[model samples]
Target: MDLEKPPAQQPPDGCLVVAIRVPVRIVMLVVVLPVRMAWDALVVAGRFLDDAVLRPVGRGLLWFGRAVFVWPFVALWRWVLVPAGRALAWLGHVLVAVPCGWLYRYVLTPIGHAIAWVGRGIAAGLAWVYARVLTPVGHGIMWLLKGLGAVLAAGGVGVAWLVRYLLVVPATWLYEWLLAPVGRALVWCVNGLVWAVRMIVTGIGTALYWTCRILFVLPALALWRWLLVPVGHALAVVGREIGAALGHAWRVAGHISRAVGRFLATLFRWIFVEPVRWAYARVLTPVGHAVRDAVLRPVGEALRAAGRATRQALASARDSARQARADFRRMLFGEPRQPRATVRREPAAADTRTLGSSTTALTKD
Candidate 1:
């Protein structure tokens, strides 16, 4: 009846003991068994799902992930790689730039300078050759030109002298020869003319003396006697006749002068006074009135009438022209034709006949 000692009842028949001696194995078994079973079931289920559906889904997800993340990463790399590479290249260039510049200065610049120097030297050599060697040739050419100019000048001088001698000597000879003959002939003709003039003067003087003696002296002597006898009688008769003729001429001249003067006076009075009176009576007053009445009034009326008529005619003409143009246009191009009606109608009828024939043929076929 000592319950305490009752042989520590043999720990539930299948209970295990572990190292800790506290039925840990049994506790572990009891507790972990269900978890392990559940884990196993889960693992089996996961395996089945993976085989059936999850694997394919995972693969699709992997592909999707690759497409979404890896492709974009690759695309980003492709897109940015050039600039990145350029940056790297620029960095490389920056790193190498100084050396390259130094290399160019030291190596390439020397070569370029050497080539330029060589070219300059060659050009200088050519120029020197041209200046030194060809200078003598140029001098020769100048000398030749000078010699040619001298020869030409000499020839020109010679030709000028020859021309002067030929032309002037010949012309002087011809002029002297021709003028000598002309001078001699003119002198001879002048001498002859003088002789003839002297002869003519002497003959004229002698003949004049003889003619005067015969015509004037002899007649004068003869007439002197005759005149002496008849002088008294002739003087008396001439005196009487002269007196009578003077008296008659004086009377006739006086009468003619009086008549002419009277006629002129009368004509003058008639011309001036009669015309003045006639103009005053017939023309001036009546003309003033007639001008006032007929000319000014009629001109004013005619001007007004002309203005009105012009305006009316212009308006009428404008309207008539508009109407005529309209009518002409209607006749020419409107629906109702005029002179060309038959011409247009013939063609239109022919076209209609042709259309009808075509239509009839089409219907028949």
Candidate 2:
């Protein structure tokens, strides 16, 4: 099935909007158009200046800065600082790391092991004393505590019975029979007094509330509703119109600026860029190609051939020097003997063990 697209929605507009919009937009446009055009002109001037002058100048300055300031530091880091850092690291390893490692291995490790052995011996002695002497003593003391607890528990039960009869029973009876009725009567009298006082306070508070509302609050509410609200709404409407007009004018000015820029760009391309491009393609390219083929290619090949010959000669000389050094070394110290190779032998059949047979020396038959 084919589906039709929905129509675009339009914003709701009233008579106030229609009356205010046109004049506000006209005023905003008059104010903004000149500014937008000047902004567009400045933008074009800045871009042209960057491309023709500032960019090339910046690049040349960058190259000069690198030669004067950056390259020397780079060379120093590569050639001098790197070697010094490596030498310092080797010295640290020898003077500090090696000595610390040697002390840890020989002196500290032996002392720690001796202290640990002594600690273990002390721990064993404490464990033996705890098990042999303290354990028996603790058992005997626990037996005496059990007997004393039994005697104390019996006396506590007797004292509890005496306290219940002598104090608790009489106190409970006195509260139930004598004090409860008097307390109830007092509570009833207090409730009556509280009710009377609450009624009098309620009447006074209600009268005060209504008096305040009529005198102060009602007038303030009337001022807000009848006077301030309408004035505020009028100011709000003016502000809204102004903001909407500025936004609409800015967008229209942007469109005009974009169109002007495009026209200027097209004119510049036709008047300047096309001729330069044509000259480069039709004239410079062929001349450059002819020069490269006739002059540069042969010189490059000759230079490469000379470099290869020089490299081969240097390699031959280096090989001859190495061979002479080896011969002199052999004359001074005799030829080195190669190491002899050893053979690995497997067990004989008589020595081989099966799963059912014992292979261990202690268990073998």
Candidate 3:
């Protein structure tokens, strides 16, 4: 009945060993199988995500990245890459600045000083060479100028002497000879002209005297006798007629003078007394009074009114100015116009004196 006592109940260690083996195998199978299945499922799921969603998203992301990063790459090329390259190039120059400054200070400065010294030596040498080379030339030029001046002076003197000898002496002799003959000929011509003039004057005087005697004296005597008789008779008639005409003209002139004097007296009396007196009584005095009353009186009244208005306006302006000045004083001093108590903080005499002087000047003004 006990199933042969279950092989007499195996040892606990053997039973525990058997039980551990089965459990280990079961555990391995259960854990390993499910983990493998789960791994396979995860792989499948990852493939599915990649094929369905991740691949498209990755493509889109890559496209978007290209689109977005392209401009950035261009910007980087322009801003960073180009600038970095330029900076790298300029770095060489910037790096050289300190050394260059140092070289210039320490090495180049000395070299420049040496060059200046050498230039001075060269300049001195050139000066010496120029002195050596130009000394002869200067002397030669001076000698040439001296020789030329001497030649010119001598030529001028010789020419003057030659001209005096050849031209002046000959011209003097020729002039004397020619002028002497011409003077003699001119004297002969003058004497002949004088003799001819005397002859002609004598002939004309004789002929004129004869003609005057024949023409003037005989005709005058005959004409005087012929005219004297007629003239005596005519003068007698003219004297009688003239006396009669003069008497008539004197009577007519006396009549005209009386008439003109009477007319002038009447005209003077009428114009001076009657017309002027009438006009003065009727028009002039009354017009003078009317003009004075109408025009001058009104003008005087208007002027007085304007003067009063102007005085009022000036007074108002003065009051407004006084008010504005008061307001300005209040704004500036933060007080009304009343004597303020002087607070002496340090008792500076100069400040007090200045303030007192200003206040006295304002009060006086």
Candidate 4:
């Protein structure tokens, strides 16, 4: 039912539209072309001026700064300051250090050593005097005391001799002259009495000995020979046989023990001793040598170096102490002088002779 058709729209003419676009293009060219040409020319002029003038001025300023400040400072340090410092160091070594070393080594050290030697000599002389003079004097005094004791002993012997001569001789003579006859008579009576007693005692002892020999010794001897001797001989024979049997058994056991000991010794040697010896010789010895060479040797060297350093330090310290002592002694005593002694002049009387005047005149004539 809604199918009716609508009327078509009429479009504008193409020639009139093209005529309007051509006039607009002509107006734009008149307005924009001159302005674009002026902008392009200004940009080209600016680029030319920057390239020709400004860049060269900046480079000139950089080169001038380098030449005036940096190059001069480097040159002064290299040419003048470094050489002057080296020269000063060399001069100091030549003038100060070398002379000090020479003075210490040559003059100061020898003087110190000489002083030490003189002091040692003085000490030795004192010791010699003590040993030679004082020790011998003490010994001589001891010997003198012993001689005095000997004199006292000799005097005691003389006193004893005097007593014997003065008293004993008189006593003996008095006894011989007065009491000898009486003493002889009394001695004769005592001898007679002692002889009677000894004779009786001998007779009694002889009777007793004979009676015991006949009554007891003969019967005891016969019984021992017949009865006790056979019994003792039979017991001795049985003991000898048993002792021989025990001795034989002991010898057999000893032989077995010695054999077992020898076998054990042989086994120990073969199983343990030889193998241990071989291992020690081949393995342990070589390992020990390797460890010694690689580790112990280096350790020993380090220790030796440390010891040398310590020894040098100790030597320096000792030298310092000695110098200090020497300085102190010098301050106290000013200077030491060598010991001197003067010999006394002997008396002149032994050099002169006295002569009789007449004899001298006769000899001169």
Candidate 5:
């Protein structure tokens, strides 16, 4: 199975892009080479400065800052602030926390309980009054209001009957007999007038719309279609080509700069790094190996031998001292007694059982 993906095909470039690309690349090369070189130079100088000067200075500054600022603050926090904080915590626990806890437990709690009991008693009294006294009073008042409402409702019905016959019935008859036909005729005439006015207004509006279209909108549309669109399209094409050319030029300039950088690096290696490497490999390595063999190795071997002899002497002295201490103890307290081994009650090896023999009472052999 072929797991590799096929390469994507790029679209073909237009003649405008092709024509602009070379000149833009040339110009970009001229412009970018100096800038790239200056940037590389600054980078090299920065690295060299950091390695040779800045690192040591920064380390010194760090030590100074630690000594002057950090260490003092750390010591103050450790020795002074921590102790002060502990003392303040103890004081607060004794003076504020203990007192507050006592007040809450012994004073406030009992007071709150008493207040709650009193409030409950007052609430109970109020509830008793409401249930016993106010409830019956409210019920009686509501009954009386209901009876009054019934009587007032009967009177309202009588007044409603009188109003219907004296005012409402006459007004209804007048409206039906006298006013209805006149209102209907007036409504018909008004509807006709409104329709005629609407038709006139609609015609006027349609004429105005057509006039506006001819005077303003059509010419503006024609100008946009015939003149502005083509000009805009051309400008867009030119802008696109310029932008593409700039991008292509920038990429080409980058490639050229990279090649220049590599060439310079190679040149530097040839001029400086190669000779140093050669000197270290061809000249210094043999000299260093000779010096090690002639001077360092023998000195190291002599030092090791001396160290072994000293260790042997120290061991023998330590053994002697230990033996003397043991003799001194023997002189003072006599020799230590040796431990005795216990005797075994089993039979000797000749009486032992073999694989073909049995020693049991039932199968003795």
Candidate 6:
């Protein structure tokens, strides 16, 4: 079954026909012709008045203005204003900057030097006072404090000695008389308790070890010697052979699995992945390209045409406005010239692609 899209709409044949309004336009021109002629005649009269009377009078007034006002003003600016400004500048510099510089150099410099010298003298006096008077007084006070500290330390030693001689002697005597015997009894009791605990722990460990040797270890040794040795030796030889066979089988299975996995991987890559890639690259990519050619390109062209039409309309309106303004000016001032042509500008192109590099990259991949 065909799943293609339907055909696009077709324009009607009669859309291109142009209707003429020759009779109405002729009637309108006939009706308004006298009024337009009158307006044009009035405009011509205004132009003649401006050119013949107004222009000559304006020229006389311009000459009068230049002679009566402009030349004298120019002369004052050149002679009086310029010279006065220069004199003012010179006077200001000589009165302000020169005096200030001289004062700063002669008066302020000496004052600053005198102040600095006084400050140096004061600093020297302070240094002398610190070295001669304050130093001796500070040393005498420190010596007194040291002597007082030494006396206090000696008193503390005497007090400590008296305390030891009194309290410590009694404490030692009491410990020797009463606590020493009690401590020796506790020591003896602790030693006896430790000996009893050691003997009990040792006896329990020896008994448990001997019991295990008799019940479990002896039976295990006998079973190993009489029964387990011969049976285990035979089993070992059999197990070795079976293990070798199983190992060989396991190696074969591993190789088979690896080969099968590789085959499956290769099959999937070819059957599924390659087909999908080819479909994307040849089918979907071309479909996208067709969409660009059929839909986007036409749309872009249509939009460009519409934009050009709109710009032409706006330019026409602007030209009409400029001409109207010029005509109005000419009617008022009696002059008219052809209007300048407006510059036409092209618009920037718009992007119409819905899918970008992402589609191409996916198709390639």
Best by lDDT: 2
Per-residue lDDT of candidate 3, residues 1-365 (tens digit): 56554456643544534444554444445445544545555766799899999999999999999889887899899999999999987997779887898889999999999999999999999999889998878999999999999989988998999999999999999879998889999999999999999999999999999899889987887777788767876665455445544544445444554566567668987989778888998989899889999999999999999999999999999999999999998898897568879976554666554544544456545
lDDT of 4: 0.81
Q: Which stretches of candidate 3 lie over 4 Å from their true place?
A: 1-216, 226-277, 333-365
Q: lDDT at 164 for candidate 6?
A: 99
Clashing pairs in 2: none
Model 1: CA > 4 A from native: 1-272, 275-283, 294-296, 303-311, 330-365
Off by over 4 Å in 6: 1-141, 224-229, 243-365
Tens-digit lDDT track for model 5 on 189-303?
9999999999999999999999999999999999999999999986786677667666665666667767887899899999999999999999999999999999999999999
Clashing residue pairs in candidate 6, if any?
Answer: none
- Listed in order, each prediction's TM-score against the native is 0.22, 0.57, 0.25, 0.25, 0.58, 0.29
Off by over 4 Å in 2: 1-5, 8-12, 49-73, 178-237, 251-365
Q: Rate the local accuracy (lDDT) of all candidates.
A: 0.77, 0.92, 0.78, 0.81, 0.89, 0.81
lDDT of 5: 0.89
Best by TM-score: 5
Cα displacement (angstroms), candidate 5, residue 303, comes to 19
- In candidate 2, position 192 carries an lDDT of 94
Model 6: weakest 10-residue lDDT segment is 13-22
Kindly report which residue pairs in candidate 4 clash with one another.
none
What is the C-alpha local distance difference test score of candidate 6?
Answer: 0.81
Order by lDDT, highest first: 2, 5, 6, 4, 3, 1
Please give the distance, in angstroms, between residue 148's alpha carbon in candidate 1 and its true position after superposition: 80
